[model samples]
Target: MTAITAPMAHRTRLRLTARGRRLLTAVAALPAAIALAFAVVSGGAALATIDDGAPAQSFATVTVSAGDTLWSIAEDIAPTADPRDVVDAIVRLNALDGAQISAGQSLAIPAEYAP
Candidate 1:
């Protein structure tokens, strides 16, 4: 005589549907996406607050004369300094779209380099 017994199963397997897998993946990625966005925003704000440690620049107005070109004006204004830098500064301070200047136009000059 022989005894027969049914085999016992130790654990059940889990199978997820395609939709369930996609939903689970999205949920898992949501936290990472939020964290990345937060890092970018905070980094930008921190960068905005960082100072270059340079002093504030001051400006003075100069009226252009009949023979005053940017080069001549910059040279007269800052003889010992670089004329190119002075001219660039003048252009920026006055917000001139081009190098063209009329005789009566007033231009802003950096105070440190002003005559």
Candidate 2:
């Protein structure tokens, strides 16, 4: 019988090559580049919404009288404009909880609708 000899096992080691290192670097930088691009795009879009030629709007004061309602006030102030829009603006300007108003109360009206 011939003598049998055991073969030595070769050990394998993991090493990152130049191509692998470059790929890893690119992957790490991808999110930062995307975030920068998104910020720039959103900033530009926000700046575009501003209108330089539009006139500045102003407000005026109105004293609430007996039997006065928001709908009636809006119509009287801005008959040419939309009553619903005017009422909404009045509500927002006064920071009122509802359309309820009392006598001797002061309210702010848009200058365009002021008499």
Candidate 3:
């Protein structure tokens, strides 16, 4: 008769169980979630940054009335601006050859200026 022998089971100290595998997966996913949130929050901020300071504001359009001069209009558009510069802007805006005034003519006034 042949002798019967049972196979021996080997032990491993570094083996991972199901729980350890689940823990590893969770740890890996945490950073991905945080990175996704960061991307969502920060995406639009750079686009809004100063493209040479946010494209200066849209110029204001005004209907000229009697007694209104280029100096007055420029002051109204940008009170802090130098009068000469304002005059130049107004001249360029309206394409005027001279400082002539008329009623009911519309002119574009620039606002929120920077050099």
- Per residue, candidate 1 scores C-alpha lDDT tens digits across 83-104 of 9999999888777887899999
What lDDT does the true structure give each of the candidates? 0.84, 0.85, 0.75
Model 1 residue 54 CA deviation in Å: 15
lDDT, candidate 2, 1-115, per-residue tens: 9999999999999999999999999999999998779769897554444544222456788999999999999999988999999999999877899989999999988776787
Runs of candidate 1 with Cα error greater than 4 angstroms are: 1-57
lDDT, residue 35, model 1 = 75
TM-score of each: 0.51, 0.50, 0.44
Q: Which candidate achieves the best TM-score against the true structure?
A: 1
Candidate 2 at 102: error in angstroms?
0.4
RMSD of each: 12.3, 8.7, 14.3
CA error at residue 71 for candidate 2, angstroms: 0.6
Q: After superposition, how far is residue 64 of candidate 1 from its true place, in Å?
A: 0.3
Backbone clash total, candidate 2: 0
Span of 10 residues, lowest total lDDT, candidate 2: 47-56
- Between which residue pairs do clashes occur in model 2? none
